[model samples]
Target: MRDLYEVLQIGREASAEEIKKAYRKLARRFHPDVNPHDPEAERKFREIQEAYAVLSDDDKRSQYDRFGTVDEGESAARQAHARWAGGRSRVNVSFGGFGGFPDLGDLFGDLFRGGGPVSQAPETPAEAAVELDFVDAMRGTAVVVALRREVECEACRGSGHTSEKVCGRCRGSGRLIHTDRVRVRIPAGVADGDRVRAAVRTTPGGEVAVAVKVRPHPFFERRGDDIHTTVPISFAEAYLGAEIEVGTIWGPVRAKIPPGTQSGQRFRLRGKGVRSVRTGIPGDHFYAVQIAVPRVVTPGGRDLVRRVGELYGVDPRSGLPLGLT
Candidate 1:
């Protein structure tokens, strides 16, 4: 009977990860299906399995390592030695004198003698997501995100075989680790809040993703393809005909006001709004005229206003039909 560590072929202080790694490697090689009818291979495989069953279970390992048995004065080692060396390999071993293991002869008779192979489970793949700044999303920028992914083993092309394995630099795992920078293009005239979807740049399993963010612009208020903003005008500018320089989403442009223009007047700058990414067509910008009225009135100004009022007549609302619902 060998020490459990020797049977598992790991250092006594080996971490669980190390233990698992060793176990996987050994199991792959010694699995009954792979080995067929080699008696030594069968025995070694059973020993590996038994060792893992104990060590992988913390409580069992702790008890076996500490008191040599769980909750008792006697040791499992003593009974186990007696059962094996005593030529009574079918004897039962108890835990805290509670439950007993049926003899290896009856319980795992075929297993120890040589049993059929066990099935292997398939593995699951991984996916990743990423975010970007406004400008990046609009103009498209390349970013590095730490992706946790498992590629097929290059050695076995994920088959786990050495000679037949693909380059593990890729992993027998089919996909190769990307070491080069990739290019991601962003379209022009993209708004502050929008998404840029891209396919897998150059990798297996086309990765679908969105670059979420906005791009920057100094003078643009986007509304569909139209932009909206206010333009200021002096009282005289609104009352008399004038062509004033107005600021639009694209830049400063000239806008004309008709005679007797009032405040809150709307003017459109055609083909000057946000450009459509799909259509590549420019939209329109609407200008709202704000009249700058004098907060304080001078004597001359008052006289002039009075004269205009007399000329225009006092009953400005005379023609209204107010009560009509």
Candidate 2:
């Protein structure tokens, strides 16, 4: 059985980030979530998790570095991390104290090995959020934005130090070395709240540009070459015949209603929807009419009904069995 160190291919001396990074990479590659029925992947995932558990803890790391057993794979990786203790110290010694002081070499060795330190903090990327409405998304829009980022220090040029105040650890190389890039494009006809990713890219100085969040719009919804809207028409306009105006992205347009039009009748306003950002040909807008009914009838309304009733008397239910009886 391979131990955790072997699974991640790292030594006990690995830092927290190193340990976590290696573990995650292996876990994702072998995770059952991505690999459905592969026995090898499942076993590998378990081994990596166990290794991460031990190496991720500092106490376990110290113990493993000393009494570690020989696993063909883990043994090699552990040695590479400098967890073992066998290196020659460059210290010079003399039989007795020199003319006025101890040998400078021995003093330097003690001070350098026991006290001198070297390491640096890597620069992380900047992040932000952007918003796009449905109309903006469907038509495609460019936006300019401002961001407060961790830029290089003008004095030290981000080396984190100056001749007078430079960081002894980094020697003024303001950034660590790593490079990655990501890019994203917004597609046409994307609905509100849809996401467009921006690819990460590395600068000459090694900085990460993360994706900004894109916001959603409330007013518009997009479909290919079609826009939809609800139109309300009064019952009188629908039943007695009249002209009704429909709202579109461009403007309001009149859609004629023939006599005795029914509720839920759809009216199509061609060439009034979203215009193509490329070709510029406009799409169509479809209006679905809902008839609005009045709440109460007046006495004059009763007279109108009576007169209309006189026009078509006998039996209003002519097709029913009651009419036949």
- TM-score to native of every candidate shown: 0.42, 0.40
Candidate 1 lands at a TM-score of 0.42
Q: After superposition, how far is residue 45 of candidate 2 from its true place, in Å?
A: 37
Worst 10 residues of 2 by lDDT: 84-93
Best-matching candidate per lDDT: 1
Per-residue alpha-carbon lDDT of candidate 2 for residues 152-258, written as tens digits (9 for 90 to 100): 44656666787777755555767443322233354453323222223234332232222222243343333434566777788668767888777776677988887
Candidate 1, residues 191-306: lDDT per residue as tens digits? Answer: 33233333443443333222233433444445545666777788778877799897765568987899888789898989987666545677788878898767899999999877
lDDT of each: 0.53, 0.52
Q: Model 2 lDDT vs. the true structure?
A: 0.52
